[model samples]
Target: MSPPPEHRRAPPPTDAETLCRTGRKVIATEAGAVAALASRIDAGFVAACQTMLACRGRVVVTGMGKSGHIAGKIAATLASTGTPAFFVHPGEASHGDLGMITREDVVLALSHSGESVEILTILPLLKRLGVPLIAMTGQPASTLARQADAHLHTGVAEEACPLGLAPTSSTTAALAMGDALAVALLEARGFTEEDFAFSHPGGSLGRRLLVRVRDIMHTGAEIPWVPEHALVLDAVLEMTAKNLGMTAIVDAGQRVLGIFTDGDLRRLLEKAGDIHAVPVAAAMTRTCTRVTADRLAAETVRIMEGKRINALLVVDAAGRLIGALNMHDLLRAGVL
Candidate 1:
């Protein structure tokens, strides 16, 4: 038997060598790409922004393969950040999706080489429709670049891929550049959190940013409350019925006087008194944290977290109890 094929283990790299070689190469490549972009921010970039801003229709982004994936993400980011945008695969655009593009819209095409045949095939039709073109590519002199109304160069010194055959560093640079453009436009248009929430109504950010306290609070008969003169047993029943771990103690006018919680019940049980005979008001916490109905659900979360409490009473400007919420409500609403 040929001496059992000798086993070899990869050598460990020294820290300084790793930093000086691999780390430095990546940093240098990305830095060079970003630095090159600074001077390249010419009239073309401004023209691209202006065209997109002036568009009466949506921004149509198109690319092929890896560029297509990046284009899809860029479209989503733009759409959520105040710009109405969507992605169209260059191959599909050449087929029938080209109908999606309108004369009033702007087209953003992506290709590292700027020579993707799929993308190039649709250029003529876009031009015929009078759609302004913004090309993002590594080759500034390629066909797409030459044909575009604006060319955003995304050239890098070298790719992070070991074989330099993959679209690793180039894709990252393109994604970052796309983010820069989206954020710039978002800020220019004074896009607010509410605007972002409208685009992402199904997400946690939307719940936290757009949901108001009143929307989630238990109101009307759902609120677990008892008169200040109610027996401790009545408060316990109210807390148990509501399952909120607490009950609000209110006066006759529905103004919150104090809050009686499971903690108060526990402490009260240890005292030399009958649970049924004690007035809940005597055992309630007088200084409970309260919020307004108009407050953001996110703010309510912050107040609860900061105060180390699980529930809050919603009050009006005059301090009358309007609603109540527990941590469970926030969690269920996707605001936590």
Candidate 2:
């Protein structure tokens, strides 16, 4: 008998509290899955890292569906962290992308079931090519696990999905395992910050590690300067002409005596002092924060931020003013 539409039973709409609890439960489940993978890492994990490290060519990562997304991210992490790698779609491999794989390269396949048809289809071809295969899968007894040169078991107790169908816990476990392998290989290869900078030249890390003060500082005639004995008016003019909002007060030898800034001008005006009447030295900051040309621009940013100033004087060993850099320069150079 069909139930009346008005009396038909449907699961009650999930309440707000249940929704919040559901989200937390999913997160907790995935977190525990990732945590478990840490202790489960064994000799297979070490062998996988060794295989990747010895790969003379790029690491070609391939998978399908959710595993494919995780594989792409893993490949990126491996490449950026010193193991050159890129992703290949397994479905496309049999069509043509398999040509991208080479004997010098290694194949890293990702599949939760270890029985993805597309992946298995190419396994025999990969074997015939004599290329090393590294598999990341949850099913250790599955066919994909048995044929690999190294198999990294990323098995999880259960999926975070309430239905236990969607890839949640397993995916998190696999991603964490991938991160573990990448970092272990990174340490084993002795990858350095400079090497990391090379891989990420357009990012903030590259700016912090690669840019030096001399690379961005204003030099020669572009520097704003005034003689120590000059009146505050002349210092202000130099500051305006150079557009740095400040001027270095120097002695006859060009050694920095102090610095005068627009902030000093504001305070002087508030005190009802005459700018023309004041000697630059009287209005200048006597103990100025300075940097050398060889310093990392990021350090220069720290100095400005720490001192609450917008400008820095670049001096040599003798403390003579050689260049000047302001916050705008740092911003323009991507140091800010």
lDDT of candidate 2 over 1-336, digit per residue (tens): 998999989996699999998889999989888888877688898789889989999899999999999999999999999999999999999999999999999999999999999999999999999999999999999999999989999998989897899999998888998899899999999999989998988998898889999999999999999997899889988988999989999999999999998988999888856667888888889988999999999988898898888887999999999999999999999877
In order, the Cα lDDT scores of the candidates are 0.89, 0.92
Q: Looking at candidate 2, what is the lDDT of residue 37?
A: 83
RMSD of 2: 2.2
Write down the worst ten-residue block by lDDT for model 2: 271-280
Residue 11 in model 2: lDDT: 95
Q: Highest lDDT among the candidates is held by which one?
A: 2
> Per-residue lDDT for 210-292 in model 1, tens only?
99998899998889999989989999999999899999998889899999988889999898357878888789999999999
Which clashing pairs does model 1 show?
none
Tell me, by TM-score, which candidate is best: 2
Clashes of 2: 0
After superposing candidate 1, which stretches have Cα over 4 Å from the reference? 1-39, 270-276
